[model samples]
Target: MRPMLNIAIRIIRNIGNIIIKNYEIQNINSDYNEYNINLFTKKINKNLNNMITKVIYNIYTKNITFLCKKKFFIFKYKKTIWIINPLDGVMNFFKKLPHFSISIAICIKGKTEISLVYDPLKNDLFTAIRGQNAQLNGYKLRCDKYFQKKNLLFALNTSYIFFTKKKNVNLINLFVENLISLRISGSISLDLAYLAANKIDCYLNNNVQNFNYLLAGELIIKESGGLITDFIGNCNYKNSTNILAGNADIIKLVISKIK
Candidate 1:
């Protein structure tokens, strides 16, 4: 419970509360289109970015990059960068699904130090420091190892189908045929959080975007004793990079299958 982390959690929770409140005010119908969704998302994103920028400046006095709705606002001062994603699952939110979250991470020289992902719908907060254990609502978390395919619960994003290669599709098919169950949650941050909490055995996404999960979710998984890497077991997970995450044994088995 460091001072900075405490401040960050408070700010994130407040922003989430605001977003949820505003979301409830909208008369969302099943007829909502992408334009309607984008309008609501932009409103929330702008408010969150502005509020977070002001609050973070008062505490860290460092550089900040707010990535919301694919827009970036950069500020300069110290070397530390606060990577903020105001909302993680805009599509789910539009569909009136309660799977989205707010992700924030403090990175220095491309290395994440403090990470936080808050789900306002569930009032669940997942957090971690660089070398400390990951936590969900202050309870420690750890990834569960599943060596047997029949016992594994794999999580993914259906959006992968839109961005994946043919090889990736084949790999996904292999997983679907082997794993006990598969879930597409529409929220990478929440998916990674569940992976760290052992709610899911593994998480695979070949179409990961930087603003989606790279900043906060990656560090949360690593801190929780989970492994994350590219499809080839390399640690180079940049924007648009493929991702495979799980425990050591599970990661090895997945790599072997995909290869």
Candidate 2:
């Protein structure tokens, strides 16, 4: 990475910290109400989004290539492409619930070479480099959660089985019977963030398309003591049509049961 790129990333990280703290303080003052809290949260998101856009424009005008989800822009040069998610859990933040996040990744030829997932709610940041250990807030994180599995708390996205041509009712029933509990949180980004914090044990949702899944899945979970793969146990990020994420043992057990 070039020195300028590193400096830009550092600036982005700093701005994220400030925004998270500001939102948290705002929520505290709003008594956790939707009306007032959401307005402030939207303002914060817009501010961050604008800053990111400026950075992207600067990089692009200089002939850099990039990819983005909405306005979370990433600049690419040569074989490297950056993936960014400016606001992960917009609804949660809007409702004064503390679970949203910011995710960024540097992919070299479609493989993540460097990545950062930051949850402003808990002030948790997970960072990783290819072929090296992942870290959570600078502390080494490992995907070992044997004890968490016995009483699993899972998170998933809600969608119809219409696309699958298979009824999910029976599968849902089976999973409910084995798992301790399940939650349908509106945001996949927050779901991964919660998993990293141990607020949730695992996350699985087969209906997710490549668009959203590619951003948050590995940025947070894989970097914070968790694993991610398709339902059939394939680790390829883009090939994962059906996703499963959790601590190693928890993910393995869930995959076995679901398959």
Candidate 3:
């Protein structure tokens, strides 16, 4: 394992602890409403970003900058980029469902070199380094979810599924009509993590702009012998508005059926 990856693991675990602790505290409060849920999640996001920046800068201050949204914010320097999503699956978290995670991607020179998605609730840590295979809790992953399965487990955000029916969302409609089995998990990181861990066969994401989730996903999926591509079999997913990801065989079958 690379030394930088070691540091990233520590950071992930540290943040995971914070999430679990806060979640437990919030669970004890029965006055859970939409307003308080939003407030709690937002506050947690801000704290995570601050802690991540502080820790990374304390060591690699001169070599790292953060990629937030569509632009990079260079905090006094630049070389490597870190996209850290403080939290994913806000709805699940609010409903007290244990499906959220903290995702981090380290990109160097426009390429993802290291990735991690840690489920604080389950303590399942998925990680990958460039050129090395992905791992889940120390076991190597290989994108072979179907080896012991009977169905083609396709995953995406549930809200998109609802939008497809109500609003006729074309971006998401392109998938629901053509895919096999459906599994909706709100967190994008978990969708990718599930694919790597053999829990899902494919994941179609409508939004590709979130490097915070997708970049980290890209590294771990590829490392696990999976691939992330646009709807038409193109490898350049970052430039596209959406992405279709799975192992090569599933990807080929999916594209063949899309209009």
Candidate 4:
């Protein structure tokens, strides 16, 4: 497992380098037009997937399977499953906002074993190996300490509003009126990582179709002493994208209101 984790770290760094290089070059030749931006994303996603597939297949052989979004592949061999999202927050990155990240999660035998969320721009790496706890760069990470509910920073994402759970609509409205500070950032993966790092205390996102983006952050939250549950407080978060995450106390409060 340690060897696999090391390999994953190496792969993530390699991907980051490519992302940084491309981002800088895009700036020099930056185009805010819709058509060019779409083309740029398509080209980078293809290249990154090729690199990841080559690296994983060469080392792990046929035993590794992938569940990558934007690009999907499933092999007969299924001992190790890799959920890789080459770039999270595509909008932010292309728009010159430095808030996107690259995340990878490895699930072997039906359980997540390792997770890594790397912020290429800042060179910040958030990682966790099951039961060993979570870390940022090398220091351990934990959710923020309990505080007055209003003071807790909230990372609320509503981009996929169309997919919103009708029942939880009240919860969203409630938070806006109740919570002291709220942030509607574009990146869900980074929001989850920030929750685990104590930078944000509560994160609620609705209707995000990319499960690839949630894989690593879900494990990161658990390993860092945070809880993740659906809007109704059920553990079946994987089946749906309506997630409510934070420390136990905050989650309980949110759920009480939702219920």
lDDT (Cα, tens digit) per residue for candidate 4, span 19-96: 898888786235577788778877787778788778877886755546544533322245677776777877788877
Write model 3 residue lDDT over 87-139, tens digit each, in one string.
Answer: 78766777778889888787777778888999998899999999988999999
lDDT of 1 by residue, 124-239 (tens): 99999999889999899877655666767888766647235666665766666775578888788889888899889888877655543556888889998999887789976563
Q: Please provide the root mean square deviation of candidate 2 (C-alpha atoms, Å).
A: 4.7
- Tens digits of per-residue lDDT for model 2, 1-259: 4444364457458667756667566544436556765576567656766776676666557667545445456677777676677666666655667666777767778677676667666667766665565667777766556564457777777665523555455457556677567787766765776676677887777776645435644755666557788777788745645777888777777666666
Order of candidates by TM-score, top first? 4, 1, 3, 2
Best by TM-score: 4
Better of 1 and 2 by TM-score: 1
| Cα-lDDT of candidate 1 | 0.77
The alpha-carbon lDDT assigned to residue 55 of candidate 2 equals 68
The global C-alpha lDDT for each of the candidates, from Candidate 1 onward, is 0.77, 0.65, 0.75, 0.80
Residue 54 displacement in candidate 2 (angstroms): 5.2
Candidate 4, residue 211: lDDT: 71
Runs of candidate 1 exceeding 4 Å displacement: 60-76, 160-166, 169-173, 176-179
Q: Per-candidate TM vs. native?
A: 0.87, 0.73, 0.83, 0.88
Per-model clash counts, in order, read 0, 1, 0, 0
Location of the lowest summed lDDT over 10 successive residues in candidate 1: 67-76
Off by over 4 Å in 2: 1-9, 15-46, 53-61, 66-71, 145-149, 160-166, 193-199, 219-226
